[model samples]
Target chain A: MALTRDDVEKVSLLARLQLTDDELNSMTEHLSQIIQYVHQLDEINTDDVAPLAHTLDITNVLADDVVADCLSREAALQNAPQRDEECFRVPAVL
Target chain B: MSSPETQPMGGTPYAVVVGLEVHVQLKTNTKLFCRCPTTFGQPPNTQTCPVCLGLPGSLPVMNRHAFELSMKTALALNCTIPYFTKWDRKNYFYPDLPKGYQTSQFDLPMSEHGHLNIFSENDEFADKQIRILRAHLEEDAGKSMHDEAAGVADSRIDLNRTGTPLLEIVSEPDMRSAAEAKAYLQELRLILLYLGVSDCNMQEGSLRCDANVNLHIDTPAGTIATPIVEIKNMNSFRAVQRGIEFEVGRQYTLWQKDKQVLGDMPKQTRGWDEGAQVTRAQREKEESSDYRYFPCPDLVPVVVTDEEIQAMQQQIGTLPASLRKQLLDDHQLTAHTSAVIVNQGLGFADYFLALATAIDDSRLAGNWMQGEVLRILNEQEQTIQQFKLSAAELGELLKFIQSGDLDNSKAKDVFAVMIESGQSAADVMAELGIEKVDSSQLEELCQRLVDNNPKIVADVQSGNPKAVGALIGQARKENSNVDPGQVRQICLALIEKL
Candidate 1:
């Protein structure tokens, strides 16, 4: 089943989006249409079909057990949106 | 065992049912479905590209290597691969996602129906086996970093991790306790690590756990239950364990009241609050939150043939399980000991297995390698490769022990020298001048030492001994080359005269 109008509105709100009414209507419609398309999987006769988890067949490719060379705090925070003398700063991301 | 099952949510008596969806990041050189770099902790936006940044008009192309690595992982987990598989657009909005939606697998995932074996603390608990429901490929979202200030004042977003290829492995709610769920997750992480599919680093958000916890109750009529809580934001295994435990108790408390308050046949989602030490309700768990999933028209469906599966399987070298089994039987190692050696990742296991194959005794090698070798590696904070003791070289040193060229004491001495300076064991034996003296020379030395100490000889003769120890120590120093065992024999013979 596709997402309902309520689901879209709720998720959009949770995401703190500034969606217009038209955008909400359209997103709801487009999302429903996509879900309808995904419903085709129901027709694939997967009763005996198992779900696939990983595409790779290989197991265990461990890196050489080496201690990580750490970066300096300044180097680590170089690209921060904002940085104070002590650390990276940014707009409230929550 | 005598207690009634506590129901999840608000129902009757029930047992907490836990299903874990583990997100593992493939340790590929690049990101999934994109050519962007997949290095974690990279500079923000440095690894971003048109496809990964989800820019308008930028078409998505599949990274064949990521797909192949995913396939190999699924096969190793014994998951059934779909003959036809494709990616879907999972519509969601978050600060982390540059695009409004994420690209992930929907109804048709990469692998399914596998099983993972888990080992728990050795007590009353039997080893547990968890069922793998499915594994799907998806792209990760960017991180939302909070400000260091008190209260949630400011936060930052880092897009460097966005578009990292992730394989989300969902497991059946077969685990009864949080411990089992934890063990399953641990074993799963090890398997993925061994498979080389995902680095599965939780600290960098490589491997994360989102647990779907509910409870099953047995009543006089039937088992009644409560709503399921989907717990999130657990950063580590300890968090996973405690989170599940808290959810179990919370659900049990709710169930003790009436169970049906949350409504039957409905599941709810919850988030874990580390400070609260309790799971808080996030939302009424969507029965099946429709994501509007669809096959991405941009990328072609992944087509893996039988030969490819077999090829991937061929790439699946000996993992911890099979190797542990073989080591248990072929070598003198106990199953517990073998499991320890095997559980220590394939590299360490490889070193031991290679050494075992080259040498006649796996028991001795397992003991020394698992104990001494691991201690050395940990003390150096280095890998087995850097330990200066190659598999063959370590095996040769063990052979020295078997040939009596080195005793247990001297073997440890030579091993220490070999490890510290990267010198050969043979060279250490020679350089340290620890080679055993000939039996005749050792006997003569012991005879002289005993003749030099008549009181010690008399004490051994009168059976007030331990005097023999002083004589052996004296003789070893006198010749420094004397075989301690031969000197002991000569000392006994000299004491008989007294």
Candidate 2:
């Protein structure tokens, strides 16, 4: 299936991405090609095989509910682009 | 335009349809996927780590205890546990979410097809079974604090609550009114509390709810259904009822003007502005496809066994509904009295059981629990666990009344002193100068009253039984230790001999 300009635009909007007209056209072509390449798997016959959730042959990989060490407030906020004294600051959501 | 009628289409009847989605935080020590403590009211960012913060190289793992707690809750709610369950990544863009996607369950959930019965003894609402569609476990996002008072355009993010384990239970639209919705919430909260799975504290955000509401109007032009609106930000159960009521009215008014049907408009999202008591439209509801849910490859799927499910079922000891029934049947208590005890939570119910069993009189124990025990709990703002007098001790005090050593009023005086000094009932009675008059002494006193009040004795022999009231008052004035009831009985017997 070919991806249209509108599909690319909608995807970008959901991802909060901004694209110029030229970039949009290129992205539309690139995404369509990628979809076409992935669609080749539809040719395989796997009626008997069950769908795989994970590659590993394992299940129920869990940890006990125990508290360990946590990063200090200073260390946690060190990598924030903008921060107040104790919290990471972002643009107003509303 | 023609003037709209005061009522919708000349008083056409309508029924409100409501479905609720409740999120309860599991009482786990650590985060769902990490070792960070899930403590509330901590300093901002102090509990953050690479896993919860969604660092590039960090991998997520499930907490075994959290999963077990969720299963326990679902089982208590009568949900069926699926053998296989997998986690999915729900993609979204929000500042509060450190990860670009939230880890949730999509096609396969932990449990499904459960039902909870909501009823009130007073018949405030009809008894109905609220059907549960599904219950899934997910991670909670961080909190975003926007300071309007500071007049800042920036919002501060607190990651302390990030990655907390949350079990979201979705119910079908089975509620017909606001009162049923509130009852459903109360019953659900009570069950969660009984299972010890979640604190179910609304003030601390341990429990939160969102409601989807709409109306079905019966008009001359067939049934007109309104668009479903999802309401959020209801801090209390009362707010939930009021919000749904407001939404129903709002939808009816809008339908009167435009006659818009269900599919005429997309589903909307609204927030309950509690101060104004109005539901303000927040935004258009997002379609489920927009989230683009896909199975997460980072975590392996969980396969539960039959034995594990049975173990969880056993772990959930008597829930509130069954316990309420047990109290009514075993103790032969009135429906109102049984409901009062069970609704105080498991601790208070346990106290009542211990007291009733110790004294071997449920009626007496139930009365004391509903009257004195509950009154003390409310007056001092204390829980049953924090109560000064233990059930065993209270039972010992009530035994005095049972044995006719002390009357009800005198026993209350002893109970007061016992609570204050932590003394035994006998000790408190002695200290209060309330001596138990022996049967011989009581008989002698009655005989003297019988002889002195010959007129009263004649009146009683003539079938004027109430004439014994004055003699009993005289007996009490003579020996302050005598019980009024015992005095009356003895006086009647002595007068009968005449």
Off by over 4 Å in 1: A1-93, B1-14, B148-154, B257-268, B271-287, B441-471, B481-498
Query: Please, what are the lDDT tens digits per residue for candidate 2 over residues B133-229?
Result: 9999999999999967567899889999999999999999988878888999999999999999998888789999999988888787787788999
Docking class of 1: incorrect
Q: Pick the candidate with the highest DockQ.
A: 2
lDDT of 1 by residue, A42-86 (tens): 888878876543445432222322222333445545654665554
lDDT of 1: 0.75
Question: Against the true structure, what is model 2's DockQ?
Answer: 0.86
State the displacement of the C-alpha of residue B81, model 2, in Å, after optimal TM-score superposition: 0.9
Candidate-wise lDDT, in order: 0.75, 0.90
Q: What are the TM values for chain B, all candidates?
A: 0.87, 0.92
